[model samples]
Target: MINLQGVSLHRGERDLLDSADCRIFPGHKVGIIGANGCGKSTLFKLLLGQLETDAGRVDLPSTWRISHMAQEVEASEQSALDYVLDGDSELRLLQKQLAEAEASSNTDGHKLAELHERMASIDGYSGPARAAQLLDGLGFSHAEQQRPVRSFSGGWRIRLNLGRALMCPADLMLLDEPTNHLDLDATLWLEQWLQRFPGTLLIISHDRDFLDAVVDGIVSFEQQKLVLYSGNYSAFERARAERLAQQQIQFEKQQAERAHMEDFVRRFRAKASKAKQAQSRLKALDRMALIAPAHVDSPFHFTLPSSDKTSNPLIDLREADIGYTDRVVVKDVQLGIQPGRRIGLLGPNGAGKSSLIKTLAGTLAPLSGERQCGEHLAIGYFAQHQLEALDSNGSPLLHLQRLSPDASEQSLRDFLGGYGFIGDRVFEIVGGFSGGEKARLALALLAWQKPNLLLLDEPTNHLDLEMRHALTLALAEFPGAVILVSHDRHLLANTADEFILVADGRAEPYSGDLDDYKQWLLGFNRDKKRKEEKSSTVSGSEEKAPEDKKTQRRAAAALREQLKPLTNKLKNIERQMAAAEKALAAVQEKLADEALYSGGQQEEIARLNRQQSEQQELMEELEMDWLEISETLEDIRSE
Candidate 1:
C-alpha cells in the first residue's frame, strides 16, 4: 500500500494541493484526473521520489520497485529494441557483471555460472521478444524495431518510451497521458494491456473511455483537494453528483432553520412576555452550525455564436484527391457538409485525418478535383498547430479585441470571462499561461467568428473534465455543421451525429457506433498478424525442404476438427450470456421505477433483487467461460 498524509504541494505561488490525503492499496488501478495545470504530473513526480512534498509524509515500502514512462527521450543511435531492453535494470546489471567476469584472467567459474543462472531466472533471453510485442502493441512496425531511436519522429519516439516503460517489471507503474499521441487502435491495445497489469497503476489521461476501461478507481483533483472515488470514470461522475446533491439539500435545510429562528427573534424582541423566548432564540441562532452553499462551480462556461446564413450544403468535395506534394492520401473522395450535420472522423494514425481537415479548411488544395464552398459559408478551423499560431505577446483581451475591434472593452472582457479569463488575468500575457488556458483562448477566438462550418482536430487534448463538459454543451447548442477528429470517445458519442472511417487511402461512411469500431479494430489487427505470419513462413521455407502436401492437408483437417467443439461451446456461452443480460436489464429497469420502493412492496423488491443477482452471476460465469473458449480457439488457429 501507498499512503500520503497532509500532503501540500505548490508550483510557484499557486497551490495545487493543500493538506490532501490519499491511500492506494496493492493491485489497485487508479486514474488521476485534473485540469492541465493541476498537479497531476507533480503528484506522479512526488510518488517517484523526484520531488519532495511541500508539507507532508508520503510512505511506501522501501523495497518496492516503481516504474514510470519517460516524458522525453534523448536522441540516440541505439536500436529501439535495445532501448526497451535497457528498461530492465537488473537484467542489464547481470549482463554487465557477466561480461566483467569473462574479461578477468582469474575469473571464478562459479561466478560466471551464477550470473548466467540469474539471467536465465529473470528470463533475460526473452527480453527482445517481449520488447517486440510491446512495440507492436503500440503501433510500431517490425522493421522499425531495428532502426535507431533518433531516426523516428517525435510521436514515434514517445511510443518507444512507452514500450520501454511497459518492459520494466515493477510493483507500481505510472503513466501520464499515454494515449495523447496514440490513435484509437493503439489506445484500445494499451487499455487491454493495462487491464491485465498485476500491480498498482496510476494513469493521468483526458480520454474518458480509456479511463473507464482501464482504471478500477479515479483520483480527482478539485479545489486543491485530492478525492478518491471507487469504480471507473463514469462511476466517479455519478458519485460526485450524488455527493453534491446531498450537500445542497443540507444547505437548504440549514438556511430554512436559521431563517425561522431569526424571524422569531426579530418579531418578539420588544414584547415583555416573549422577551425571554426571543433572547433564547437569538442565542440559538448565534450558536447554530452554518452550512456552506453548494457550489459546483465550473470555471468554464462559453457558447458558440449562431452561424451566419448558408446554403443547404455548407461545403462540398467532388472527386477530391487530398495530400501533400507527390503524395496522395485520400483519393476520389466525395463529401457534403450540410447545415447542422455533425460528423466524426475515425482512423488509425498516419491515415490522413489531419490531411482531410486541412483540405477542408482550405489550407491544402485538392490535387485533382473540384472543391466547392457555399456563397455564405464561413469556416472555423482548429488544429494542434493553431495553438502555435497565437501571438505570444498578446493577452486574452487583446486576442478578443482583434476579433471585435468595434466592441467595448467591458464587453470583450465579459466574453473572455466565459472561457475562464476573469478580471486581471485577461490582461496578463498569454505567453506565460498554461496549455489549458491557451486552448481556452483559442476556442474563444474561434467561437467569436460565428462561422457556419466548424472543423476541429483533437480539440479536447489539453482540456479538463469541466472544460470538456462545457465544450460538449456548447457544441450541442451550436447551430452549424461540425467535422471533428478526436480520440475522446465521450465527445464523439455526444457531439457527432455520424462517423466516417478513413483507411486504405480512402474515406467512407461507417454504419456503426464506437463499440462496433472497437470490434472492427480487433479483427483488423488479427488479420494483419496472420498476413505477417504467412509472409514470414513463405520467406523461411526457401531454406528448408518442401513439406508433403498430404501432410499439410491432414494437419489442417485435424486442427479444424479440434476447434469444432470449442467454437460451438463459445457460441452457446454467448447465447446464454445474452439471455442473462436481457433478464438483468429488465430487473434493473423495474428497480429504477420509483413505485418499486413504495410501501407494501418489500417482498416484490426482494424477489426482483434476487432475480437480478442470480442473472448477473450467471452472466459473469458465462463471460469467463466464453473468454477461455475464445482464447483456446485463437491458439489453435494460430498454430
Candidate 2:
C-alpha cells in the first residue's frame, strides 16, 4: 500500500523517472521491467528513501517493515543458523529474556505469567528446533548448518541473506534480481515459497518465466513514466504494444489538430468576431498537457554474424580424463560434435562440469586420454567465474574492444543491451559490476567473439528467466556446436539437442528428454529419502537416512504396487512395515522431547522402537529384490 505521485528523477544528463505516478497495492505480485540504466535501481533508492526527490512524494504507511539486500554484501564469520536467527533481533531478544524468565522460577506469579505470554508471542524462537527446520528447508544438511558462514561461497551468502529476508514477516519485500545467484532447484523452491508468501511483493528481475509464474502485474519503465498493467509479463507486453500503437495514432491526430487550431488562430486573429473564437482556441491549446507518445521498441533482438559453414568438426574428446592436478574427476569420456549440435552438460555441483568444459576449450590438459579438434574449429568459451577472468585494469567497454577490435559501436551496444548493459554501463569499470552484471558481460562477449564452436559453462548462473530464454533461442539458431554446462531446466530443454550427464565418473548419451531428466531426478530424491529413512545395518547396507520420514514410506509403497504379481510379496510386506516404523519413530521423538509423558507409556515406546529396527532390515531386503526385478524388466521390455 504505497503511491508515488508525480515523481521526477534524473541521473546525470538523462531523465530517468520523469513526473511519474505509480501505485503499489497490498497483496499484488508486482515485477519491474526495464533496460539497464533506465533508472530501475535509481527508482529503488527513491522507494528506499536513500535519495532525495526534487519533486513529488512517496506515500507509505509509517509502520511498514522493509528489507533491502545490497548489491555488495559483507558477510561476517557467523554460523549459517546464527546469521539467519539474527533476522528478527527483537524476537531473538524476547526469546532470550523468555529463557531467562523460564529458568528462574520466581515467586512473583504475575510477572511470570506475563513473561510466558510475551514468550509465546515471539516468532521463530524455538532456538535449535526452528533453526534446523529453516536450514533443512533451504536444502542445507546438518553438517552445512553447523559450519561457519565463511566456509560458504558468495552465492551461498546471498542465499543466507535471502533466507533472512523470508524469515522476517513484512508488508512488502523488495528484491533486485533475486534469481541472479541461485541455481535452478533453489530458484524453483524460492518461486514456490514466494507464490505462497502473504505480502505485497515488488521484484526487479530479468526472469520472464519467474515473473509470469509469480507476478500479478507488470510495471514498465518507458518514456520517463511508469506504465502499469493489470496482468503478468505476457499480458503487459500485449497491452503495451496496443497502447503504444494507439498512442502513436493519437499523437499524430493531436499534432494535426493542434496545428489546425494554431493555423486558424494565426489566420483569423485580425477578424472581428472570429478573433474571440481564435483566442478561446489558443487558450484551450496552451492548456493541453499532451504526453510525448513513446515509440515502442523490442528489448533484446540480435543475430549472430553468419560465418562460413565449415565442414570441420567443432570439438572432440576421446577417452578424456579431465580433472584438477592428480585428482581424476571425469574419465573414459568420448565426444564428437560438429558445427550445429547444441549439447547441454547436465549434472549437479562438483560433478566436474566446469572441468570438462575447460578441458574441451583447451584451457586445461587432461590427466590422461586423447583429445583433438577438427581444423578451423574456433572455440569461444564463457566461464562461470567471469569476475576473475575479466581484466581488472580495464574499463567495461575497453575489455570488449580488446577482444573484438573491429566490432562497430552499434554492434557492441546491441550485444550489451541483450544482457542489460546499455549506455554508460559499458563505461563503468568491469570490477564495479555485480555478480549478475559480470555474468552478463561474459555473455555479451560470447556474442561478439563469433566463434565457430561455443563452450558455455553455467552461463545461466546469474541470468533471469527471460535472458536465459533469449540465450536459448540465440544458441539454438547459431550455426555452432554448443557444449554448455547449465543447471537451468528451461534453458537446457529449449537450447540443447543432446544431453550429456556428467556424473559418477562418466559422460554418457542420455536418451531421456528434459521432462525425463526431471522425472529421473525426482526418483533419485525419493530413493535418497528411502535410504535416509533406513536406521540400521542390514545384510547388505547403503546410505544413511534421517531418523523420521513420511514421504519415503509412500514411495516404498508405490514400488510394492509395481511388483504386485511377485510371488515373494517382499515389496508389499516391506511397504507396510515402513509405515509402522514411521509411526514408531514419532513416538520415539516424543519420548526424546519428554513432553507430557503420561504414566504407563514406557512399554509402548519400547515396542515401537523394536518394530522400527526390524522394519529397517525388511525394507533393505525388499529394495534389493526390487532392484533385481527392475533390471530384469528393463531387459525384457527392450525386446
Candidate 3:
C-alpha cells in the first residue's frame, strides 16, 4: 500500500503535480489517467524514489515490495526465459549456489549443508515453476524459451522485461500501457491473470477496453490534482461526464450573476437617485470572479480530405510474400481489398500485420507476389513512427508545406490549429514536439493528402481514449479504402469492415466485428492452454480402483484428451465464420462509399451478406457442440 500526502512536483519551471493527495490500497487495482505530459509517469517516479518531492511526503508501507514495468528495456545474449528468470533475484542466486553444490561431491561439509538448505528452500517454493508460468502467460512460446534474447526485436524485449517485472513478489504493481504491443489473445490472457492476481495495482493505459477489463478504480490528474472514481474505465467515463455537466451548470449560473451585476452598475452609475445602488453593484461586480473549471480543448479536427469516388477493384494481391530483408513475414497469400473497403490487419506482435499494410501501400516490395491497384486509388500511408521519421530540423510549417504544397496560407493555419498547433508551435522544429504532437502531425498530414486508399499502422498510439474514439468516427466516415493495423480493439471494431489475422506466414480472414474477433481469440487461447496441459502428461499403468484420487485424476485426464480435438475443430469453424462476417462488413462499407461517390469495383454486398449468414449459422452449431464438450469435461473435473 502507498499514499501521497500533499505532494508537489515540478519540472523545468512547470508544475507537473501540485499538492495532490491520494491513497493506493492493497488488493485493489487502480488506473492512473490524464492527458499526455500531465505527470502520470512523474507520479510513478516519485513513488519509486526516482524523482524528488519538493513539497510533501509520499507515504509508503514500512516494508513493501513494488515492481514498475519499464517503458525502455535492455537485455542481450540471454534467452527470453533466462532474462525473465532475473525477476526473482534471490532465487536466481540461490539456484546458482545449489547447482554448484550438486555438481561437486566433495565440498566444505559445513558450507555444502548451507548450500543444500538454500537450494531445498528455493525448490520447495517452486520458484522456477513460477518463472515459467509468468513467461508463458506473457506469450513466450515454449519453442522460443531457450532462444537467445539477442534474437528478439526491441518490442519483444519489452515483453521480456514485463515478464521479469511480473515475476517479482510485489504487493503493488505499476504498469504503463502494458497492452500496447500485445495481441488480442495475449491481452485477454493478461487481463484474466491480473484479475485473479491478489495485489494492489496501478496501471496507466490509453486503452478503454483494457482499463475496463482490469481496473476496479480510476484516479485522474486534472488541474494539478488527483480525482478518484470508484469504478472501472467505463463507469468513470460516465461519472466524469456527469460531473462536468454539473460544473457547466454551476458555471452558467455564476456567469449570469456576474452579467446581472454589471448591468445594474451600468444602469445606475449615471443617476444620483441610484448612486448608492450603483456603488453597491460596482463592488459586487468587482468581487464576483467567475470560476473557470479545469478543462482541455481536445484538438485535432481530422476529416478526410475530399476525394473523388474510387473505381472498382481497389487492390488485388496474388501469391503475396511481404517482409523485409531475406525473411518473409507472410507468404503465398491471395487476397483482394476492394474500393471503399475498411479492413483491419490483426495478429500477434511480429505476425506481419504492419508488413502487409506496407506492402499494400507499395512502401515495401513483395518478394514474389503480384499486386495490382485500381485506376484512381491514391494511398495515404501512416507509418507507425510517422512523426518520428520526419526531418527534425524542419519547422511544423515547413513540414506542412512540404506535405501539402498546394495549400493557401489561411488553409494551412486552419489545418495546423485543428491539431493544437498554434502560431509558435507551427514554426517549431519537429524535433521539439512531444509524442502526442508528433502523432497529431502525422494524422494532419494524412488528412491533407485525401488519398482514396488509406494505409494506417497503429495510428492510435500516443492518442488518448477520446482522440481514439474521434479517429474511429473519422475513419468510419472516410470515403475511401482503408487498411489499418491497430492494437485498439475498439477502433478496429468501429472502423474496420473486415479482419485479416496474419500468423505463421499466412493470413486467416475473420469477421471484422471486434466482439466476434474477441470471442474467437478467447476460444483459440483456451484451446492452446488445453493442449499445453495435455502435453504435460505422464504414462500410467492400468490399475483397478474402487474409488481413489488417482482414479479421479485419470478420469480428468481422459476427459481433457477427449475435449482437445473437439475444441480445435470449433476454433477452425469460428475462424471461417469470422472471415465471412468481416468480408460482409467490408462489402457493406464499400457499397455505402460507392453509392456516395462514383465508379467503384467490388463484390456485391447482398451476396456477401447471404454467405455470411450461412457461415454464422454453421459456426453457431459448432459452438454448441464445443460448449457441450467443455461442460462435460468440467463436470468430470468437478467430480
Candidate 4:
C-alpha cells in the first residue's frame, strides 16, 4: 500500500495540502482530481520523491517499481521505438552486457550464456515488439515509429512520452492527463489499455468518462485536503454532493439560530428584566463555531452569447473539398448549419475534422465547391492555436476590453468572472497563467463576441472538470449553432445533437452515438490493416519467386471459410448491442423528462429503471462476446 500521513505541502505562500492523508492499496486504480493548481501533479512528484513534504511523511514499499509519464520529452534524434525501449533500463543494461560479452576477444561462453538466460528471463528479446505495440496503440504508424523523435510535432512527441511510460515495467504507474494530446480513437484505445493494466494506477484527468471507465476509486482535492472516495468519478460526485447538501442544511440552521440571538440581544440588552438573558445569548453567539456554507457550485458559469441578428442557415457547404493547397483531406462535403444546430465532428486524428471546421469558419477556403453563408452569420472560431495567439502581456480584463472597448470595466470583469477569472485573477498577466487559465481566457474572449455560430476544436484540451462541465452547460444553453470537435466523450454526448464523421476523404453524417462510433473505428482500423498487409504481400511476391497460385488460393479460401462464422457472429452481436443501446437510450430519455419524476408515476419510473438496467447488462454481455470473437479472428489472421 501507498500511504500519506499528515502530509502538508507548500508552494511559495500557497498551502496546497494541509495535513492531507490518503492510503492507496496494491493494484488499485485511482484517479486524482482537482482544479488546475490543486496539486494533482505535485502529489505525483511527492510520490516520486522529487519533492519533500513540509511535514509528515509518504510511505510506499521500497521494492515497488514506479513509472510515470513525463510532461515533456527532450529534443533528441532517437528513433521513437528505441526511445520507448530505453524506458526499460534494466533490460537495456542486460542487452548491453550480452552484446559486450559476445563481442569480447576472449569469447567468454559461460558469461554469454548467463547474460542470455537473464535476458530471456526478462523477455528482453520481445522489447522492441512490445514498444512497437505501445506506439501503435498510441496512434503511431509503422513508418512513424521509426522516425526521429525530434522530427515529430509537439503533440506527437507527447504520445511518444506516453508510449515510453507504458513500455516501462512497474508496479505503480502515474499518468497525468494522458488523453490531453490524444483524439477520440486513441483515447478509447488508451482507456481500454489502462483498464487491462495490472499495476496500481493513479491518473489525473479532466475527462469524466475516461476517469470513470478506468479508475476504481477517486482521490479528490477538496479545500486543501485529499479526500479518498470509493467507486468512480460519478460515485464521488454523488457522495460529495450529499455531503455538501448536509453541510448547507447545517449552515442554514446555525444562521437562523445566530440571527435569533442577535435580534434578542438588540431588543432586550437595555431591559432590566432580560438583561442577563441577553448577555448570555450574546456570549453564546460569540462562542458558537460557524458552519460555512457549502461551496458546491462550479467556479465557471458562462454562456456563448448569440448574435442579435437572425440567420436561418448560418453556413452551407455543397460539394466542398477542404484541405491545404497541396491536397484535399475531406471531399464532397455537404453540410448546412442552421440556428441552434449542434454537430460534433467524429473522426481519427488527421481525418480533416479541424480542416472542416476551418473551412466553415472562413479561415480555410474550400478547395472546390460552393460555400454560402447567411447575411448575419457571425462565427466564433476557437482552437488550440487560439490559446497561443493570446497576448501574454494582456490580462483577462484587457483581453475582453479589446473586444468591446466601450463596455464598462465592471461589466467586463463580471464577464471574465464567469470564466473563473475573478477579482485579482482578472488583472494577472496571461504569461503567468497555467494552461487551464489560458484556455479559460481564450474561451472568455470567444464568448464575448456574441457569435451566431461557434466553432470549437478540442476546447476542453487544458480545462479542468468544473470548467468542462461549465462549457457543456454553456453550450447546452446557447441559442446559436455549435460545431464541436472534442475527445471529451461526456461533452460530446451532452452538447452534440448529431455527429459528422470526417474520414475516408469525405465528410458525412454519422448515424450513431459515441459507442457505435467506437465500434466503427475498430472495424475501420481492422479493414485498413488488412488492406495494408495484402498490399505488402503483393509487393513482396513481385520481387521474389512466385508461390504456387493454386496452393495460395486454397489457403486463402480456407482462411475465409474459417473467418465466415466468426464474422457473422460478430455482426449479429453488434446488431443486438445496438438495439439494446437504443432501448436503453429511450428509457433514459423518458427518465430525463421532468414529469416522470414529478410527485407521481413511481411504478412507471421503477419499471423504466429496471428496463434500463436489463438493457445495459445485455449490451455489456454482447460487447464482451464481440470482443472475444474479434480476438479469436485476429489470432487466426495473424497465424
Model 4, span 21-47: residue lDDT tens: 999999899999999999999999999
Over all chains combined, what TM-score does candidate 1 have?
A: 0.83
Residue 342, model 3: lDDT of: 66
Q: Which tens-of-lDDT digit does each residue in 29-125 have in candidate 2? A: 8999876567778877887889977789898888878765556546567888877777666667777776787688683778767766776676444
* Model 3: lowest-lDDT 10 consecutive positions: 287-296
| Lowest-sum lDDT 10-residue window in model 1 | 286-295
Q: What C-alpha lDDT does candidate 4 achieve relative to the native structure?
A: 0.81
Q: Clashing residue pairs in candidate 1, if any?
A: none
Candidate 2 structure, TM-score to reference: 0.68
Could you tell me how far off, in angstroms, the CA of residue 478 lies in candidate 4 after the best superposition? 0.6
Q: Which candidate wins on lDDT?
A: 4
Total clashing pairs for each candidate: 0, 4, 12, 0
Clashes of 4: 0
Off by over 4 Å in 1: 98-109, 249-296, 536-559, 576-639
Residue by residue across 373-424, what tens digits does model 3's lDDT show? 8887778889876766778898777878997688787788887787777887
